[model samples]
Target: METAQLQREIREFAVSAGIDKIGFTTADPFLEMKNRLRRQQESGFQSGFEKGTPDERTDPSMLMDRPESIIAIAVAYPSKMDNPPKGKKGGRRGMFCRASWGQDYHDVLREKLALLESFILERCPGARLKSMVDTGELVDRAVAERAGIGWSGKNCSIITPEFGSYVYLGEMITNIPFAPDEPIEDGCGDCTLCLDICPTGALIEGGRLNAQRCIAFLTQTKGSLPEEFRTEIGNRVYGCDTCQTICPKNKGRHNRFHAAFEPEPELAKPLLTPLLSLSNREFKERFGHMSGSWRGKNPIQRNAIYALGHFREEAAVPELVRILREDARPYMRGAAAYALGKIASDEAITALGHAETAETDAEALEEIRAAIRNIEDMQKEVPK
Candidate 1:
């Protein structure tokens, strides 16, 4: 088959599989991106791996057992969610970051990629395929840009005017070299809304991000927050979209990704009150197919406590007290106790007693006591 015809067939198959945008590129046009990935890996900004040898990332011969071509694809996830009003009290809010308003993209993307691979194999017998998304070490965002799928915006995200920065990208490394598409020149002409609107000050200059300061990383990282970005995390329990939300391209567009990707109504604007009541079984059932399920319940609940702390809602105190004494996850216990203490309920003083003595970690114990004192001082304002 002619390479052009093969590429067209591949594109046709991908669209049939529900992928919105498909783009192809020569195998090595993304060498600069691969080089950047190596530098990022070496610099040690949360991605904990050694820099790949050039042979590992750029050389198709090294990356795939049977080297040939590169194909990259993106699925746009636009943001048109209507979160409930912040309300008069500004206490426990009803909302989620827009990305969580859908079926988990990892599963969606995987199924589509597998089907695409099967289609290719049927057409080109003996063709080999290895597909990956963000989970893999290959430079994904760069691949999307090189594929002519979109231009990399100043925020360092692949931006399509159709979907803005709200897109999930994946690629197939294959043994069949097809006709390639020309990469688009980057079109981020001096719009710094993404940089200016970052609450955590994460975005640095033109395209650099201080992952240490990124609100998204803070919510997902397995350890305690770095004391600074925690406040910026606010009500965001999962990923952060502050950058994308501020971009002109993301505003006022009607989001029309795959219907299967649409979120459940409760998930779209979940109440903190109900999520607190969720048993582990309920947590799995509620979030199992959603993006929030990927990191497990501990982080989600811990983030809930962080939001409660920021809101200082006394209504959350009872649940917080129970979590302090009984929750199995230590971070959940600590976070709940801290939020409860900030709410200044009578339970705060007693929970700190259990927390300080039972807590083996010296640092956690100190945090417990600090929360205790802060609440006690706030309690002084109450009339006798």
Candidate 2:
């Protein structure tokens, strides 16, 4: 069979397999991406969850032998949840990002890739193929851009004209020489809404992101969040979508075709107070299937505390007090203490006072002391 004909067949097969978009590129080193990555490293801008070394990440041949063509695929996920829950005064809710709404995307995309691999191997028994999803050695976004999947947006996401930026990307590198697709023209023009609207200013001027200041990255972290970024964390329990949500390109873009990516309202926007007391088994039973639970309950619970604080929900004070006084994990204890301080009611102040005296961990003790100081400052400001 002609390679062009085979490529056509593969494309048709991809559409049948529920892949929203597909594009092809040659096996070439991403030299420009390598330089940008180096700059990100030097400036401490990388999220640290990135998989491979710079050289390994930029070169396809390093991963697969004599890779002649690359296949990039995207699966769109729903941006809006059905009948989304609203947070109220007493029943404040924390959100999981749209990317994490449904089942773990890693599993969804990998299933498609595996089927693609099987389809190819059966047609050309000698065909050599290597496939990877987000956790792969090569960068999924860079591969997608080269394969004409979309233009890289200023918010550091690949924005497809059809699906906006709410798409999951994956790729397969093969030895067969398939025709490469043309790269898309840059469509961002002069829009900087993503940069201007980022709560933590993580988005730099030229499509670069300082991941250290990114709320999305911050929510996934296990430590007590920095005092500066705490206020900006808002009610996000896992990841953030502010940059994508504000983009003009994503206006009215909502893909709901894939059932696997449909969100359960209760899990996607869980109640904040109950999250503080979720046991390991309960956390797993409730959120284990979602991608947001990848970091386990620690980050989610910690972020929930921060979210409650962000709302200054007095209803959460008792739960925060219990966590501050009893949680074994210092980070969780510290975050709870901070949330108590943010509430700053008479009961919250009293709890903080008790925590300050009983807390033995130096770090948690500092958090308790800081909360007490903040409450004292607030009390001083009140008119006599």
Candidate 3:
């Protein structure tokens, strides 16, 4: 297959595989992105950065690794449901973001990516193909931007004007060379909604992120959360979408495409209590198929306490106390104490008393009292 013919053929295969858009680009290093990464790391915005983290996520190795031509694709996960219901949520009527409303996209995208690779392999027998989703360190957003797919929004998410940032990105690296698409000019001129609405101020002075302050990272990170950061976590149980929701580009985004984007049962406005009760086995059984669950059930479980705190529903007291009893991580335990303090139930009060007995952390002990006071205020129906 010739280059032009191959591009058309590959695009056809992508569309047939349920992809929304497909574009091609040549391999190029992202040296301009180096300073951005450096700033992010220095500002403590990175995760999984134990040591020796590669620059591939910001560099062009993604395209240059083994291939000369790159194919960038997107899978949209649209939502038709309303935002999750506010206050005392249980059962299905609650809320879920459109992205997580249904089957996970990682597996879906992977299945298609492999098939796309197979399609390429069949066309070019000697050509090697590499596929990447969110897990790769290569700069997917940059590649997509270069391929005329979209431009990176102020929030750092790819914004395809028509599809917005509510889409997932994937790539196919192949030895089969093809012409690269013309890069799209930045369209987010002077838009600050994504930055203005950030509750944690993860968006710094420039269009960058401080991962430590990012609610999404706070929800998924292992270990206990700082007391100062817990209350700000708000109602988000897993990841934070505030920036995306506030993006003007995403305005009036009615999810009519991507039928695969439906919520898992538990994820459809999960009860804070029931979620706190899930063990590793139960957590896996419930959220195993989710892209959010790959980090293990602990982080999500911990965030439930924070959500309950934000909800301040008396109905969630028993569940919160139960987690407080079995919770071991200082961060999670701390979040539990903070949430329980906000609930202020007799049951919660009793549990906090018990937690205070052996709990040695001075800050956590203070938060326990604060949690109890918050519960008292809530019980009195006082405005926070």
Candidate 4:
């Protein structure tokens, strides 16, 4: 089969298979990305969750023998939910970001990629191909940008004119020499909205990000969230979409092309109080299919406590007190202590005082003491 003809046929097959966008690029080493990654590592800007070293990540040859071309694919997801549930005082809710709205994207994209792979194999029996989604060594955004699928936006997302930035990226490196597509022009000219609107100032300049300060990364961490970011985390239970929401390019671009990406209102914006009491089995049964539940229930539950505190929901005080007094995880107990302090009612204060004496973990004990002091300071500011 002729390479160019094969590429055209693959694109046609991709459309029929539900891939929204597809492009091809030469399997050359991503030298610029390698340098940038090195800088990111040296400055400690990278999230520890990144899968590969800079060299392994940028060099496609390292992943496959004699790589000739790379195929990049994007599947657009919904940016807005239909009849979204609203959070109120007594029944406050915490939200999962739009990217985590529906099914785990890794599974959805992998299924599409598998279909594409089988199609290619049937056409050319001896073709050597390697495919990967977000977890793969090669960066999906870089591959997509080079393949003309999109341009790399200032917010570190690949922005497509058709779908905006609400798209999941995946790539395949193959030994077949498919004709490479031309790159897209940079479209985010002079736009600083995503950088300016970030609550924690995680976006450093246009294209760089300090992942340690990013709310999306913080929500996935197993330990207690740092005190500085607790208030900034707001009502987000998993991930943050401040940059994407603020981008002018994404305005009116609510791509709901895939049915699997449509959100469930109750699951996406769940009630806060009920989250704190979920057992491991219960949590899995409820949220296991969603991408946001990958870190398990602890982080989500901890963030729920922060959301309750952010709202200062007096109704949640009893639940917060219970978590502070009896939850087995020290992080959960500590997070509950902070939320109780934020509520700052007499009931919350009394619960904190009682837990302070009984708490064995030094860190959790200190949090209890600080929460007590916070309530006392607030009380002092009140006039008789």
Clashing residue pairs for model 4: none
- Residue pairs with clashing backbones, model 2: none
lDDT of each: 0.73, 0.92, 0.73, 0.94
Q: Could you tell which candidate, 2 or 4, scores higher by lDDT?
A: 4
Q: Report the lDDT of model 1 for residue 93.
A: 58
Worst 10 residues of 4 by lDDT: 318-327
Per-residue lDDT of model 1, residues 155-255, tens digit only: 77888867777888898988777767888876778888888888877777767777767777677666456556656778777878778777887776556
Best by TM-score: 4
TM-score of predicted structure 3: 0.87
What's the CA error at residue 253 for candidate 1, in Å? 2.5
What's the CA RMSD of model 1 in angstroms? 3.1
TM-score of 4: 0.99
For candidate 1, the TM-score is 0.88
User: By descending TM-score, how would the candidates be arranged?
Assistant: 4, 2, 1, 3
Displacement of residue 172 (Cα, Å) in model 1 is 1.0
lDDT, candidate 3, 290-313, per-residue tens: 777778877777777777776666
lDDT of 2 by residue, 1-384 (tens): 789988999999999999999999999999999999999999999999999999999999999888899999999999998789899999999999999988999999999999999999889989999999999999988999999999999999999999999999999999999999999998999899999999988998848999999999999998888899988988999999999999999999999989999999999998989998888899999898899999999999999998899899999888888888778899889998888888998898888887778889999999989888888898899999
